[model samples]
Target: MSAHSPSELELERRAYRARQSRRSVLVAIASSIAFALVVWVTVINTSGWAGVQQAFFDPAIAWDALPRVWEGFLLNLQVLGLSVVTVAIVALLIALLRTLQGPVFLPLRALAAAYTDIFRGLPFIIVLYLVGFGLPTLADERIPVIYLGTIAVTLTYSAYVSEVIRAGIESVHPSQWLAARALGLGYGQTLRRIVLPQAFRRITPPLMNDFVAMQKDVGLISILGATDAVLAARIESAQTYNFTPYIVAGILFILLAIPTIRLTDWYTARLRRREQTGALL
Candidate 1:
């Protein structure tokens, strides 16, 4: 069969829309340029701009610090990598415990609830200090600072991620459980095959947000004398009294976070589109 040709009015409307799109793009670019120029002019004209630039934006200092900071950043990545795995395991178990239905499970549920409440209420830095210093004193063998830091991170984030996972699990419709059971699926099978997949899909954006937050927080391990990026920056800064290394570390973290941030945004929009279109999967 021959394809039907577009009508004259349809072609004209398409051309009009194209023109509008082009105009919008141009306007956006122009406005962005203007805003940037205003910011540059305002910033440079400030009284302390020169001192601030020398202290925080020195190219030479940044270049000098980059290698050490990058090395330390690898440690941060290691902590983050281990924490992600540990958090997933611990959080999933806690979430599952919280969701279990039985009179006998009351203690488990209460413990999970208390775990979340306590950790979530405690400041992360305090937890880091407690775990970092307190753990070392109790063990006869010397424990690595990195390990202690990772444990602290795991303890803190597991509580938060468990809540997120539990919320996702609860968000699944009750009928899904009944339908899976009606098809001869066991509770575990229903959760694995039917419920968790959907819950993960629904919760992915928030999960990614949590992951990004984790990426930044992993640098906190530096406080435990683990010599991560932040400590490296501090060392470099102390040498010359220039804060530029700190800026370099900040930029590196921002660069690390950018891809995940963009991915989260893209997936969130994709999910929104799917939901709007009533996609089943």
Candidate 2:
């Protein structure tokens, strides 16, 4: 055989590998199906499947809950969008403040540190309660509940995001900052033009993770009865005496979360590849 051409043995080996790969995939699928079927059969036989069906699998109840839950989910998306934007902006500022150098910036740095610590230390529900119920009254009750809830989310997440942003910023080497300074760039210019871009790229995976977490935590706003999916489900369950609406809401949340989860996974994989490449270099 020519140097580039496969020999007969090589052709047979390739064919065998391809067939093995296909067979392995089929086996995996069949095994998964069989395992699930066995578990399901056990559950159905042991537990009263009829009660389970009535509680969780009622099609009519699900159908009735769908429209209201969807309407509430739209509100959830709105709040989540606003909170994410707010958190991003606030966290960036806090991170910048936290990273500031010298006595001139000490107070700001301390305040930023305190903010992150206090907020991060607080339970999520307390933040919701304080912001949703407490903050509005300070403004003579002018703020709307949805707006207040958004603020709560913003306050709670900004602490976490600020830490992530700070980590990203600090991960950029000191040499890059010095190099920018050597080019006659000011501190702000160095950060804006040289450091932040690389930092953001390096931290995309963690930031994506943070955003995914925030997506699900957005459900907490429903506790304030602002008519989010969770609240909608609760209301429906109360009316119907069936818990299927909660399941429906849970499924809706899972559906909403899937894209972010996939994106997080993709970004993490890419980050790993880049780190591996750097290690090789």
Candidate 3:
């Protein structure tokens, strides 16, 4: 059998689509350059630009601060890694508790609901302070601040992540659970083997967004005297009376978050396209 080549009309359509794509790309690039140029002009024309640049954007100061900030950033990364694992475990348990469907489980469900509600409404910094300061006193032990910070982050984020997970679980079709049950699968088995896998797929983008947020917030551990990047930057800033070290820490955090942020966006768009078109890719 001979393969059929594209028809002339099909070829023309492909060529036109290619041209349109190229035009779109070129237009995007041009618009970006124009916007950047306008921003540069506006900022440089301001009377305080020179002082602001010296205070916040001094390259020499950034270089001077980099070693301490980098060392401290490693601690932030450690806390973030620990917090991610703890948050996932705690959030899943809470989500499961919230999803339980029985009068016998009413108390558990209510407790979980109250936990999420309170934590979600509370500011994370306040939680950090409470956990960082209060927990050590209660234990009557000299606990490390890094551990306290990680615990605080896990508690606050678990509330948010649990809601996202619960939403994903609820978004799963009820019929799937019924079908699993009909197949003689227990409730836990149905959730673990059938429902949760699908829910996780649906919720991955939001989970990643949360992870990116955690990366930035982990820097806040410095408030507890863990000497994480933010604290190191502050110490340097105080010594030099320049804010450049803070900018350096901020930039490092932005760099840390960029990959996860982009991944979340890409996954979101891919999920949207699959939902709209019924395409697996």
Q: Where does candidate 2 clash, by residue pair? A: none
What is candidate 3's lDDT per residue for 84-123, written digit by digit as tens? 8999999999999999998999999999999999999999
Please give the lDDT score at residue 273 for candidate 1.
Answer: 90
lDDT on C-alpha atoms for all candidate structures: 0.94, 0.90, 0.94
**Pairs with backbone N, CA or C atoms under 3 Å apart (clashes), candidate 1:** none
- For residues 23-49, write the lDDT of model 2, one tens digit per residue: 999999999999999988888766688
Worst 10 residues of 1 by lDDT: 272-281
Candidate 1 TM-score, C-alpha based = 0.94
How many residue pairs clash (N, CA or C atoms closer than 3 angstroms) in each of the candidate models, in the order given? 0, 0, 0
Which 10 consecutive residues of model 3 have the lowest summed lDDT?
272-281
Indicate which candidate wins on TM-score.
1
- RMSD (Å) per prediction: 2.3, 2.6, 2.3
Which of 2 and 3 is ahead in TM-score? 3
Per-model TM-score versus the true fold: 0.94, 0.90, 0.93
Question: On a 0 to 100 scale, what is the lDDT of residue 11 in model 2?
Answer: 100
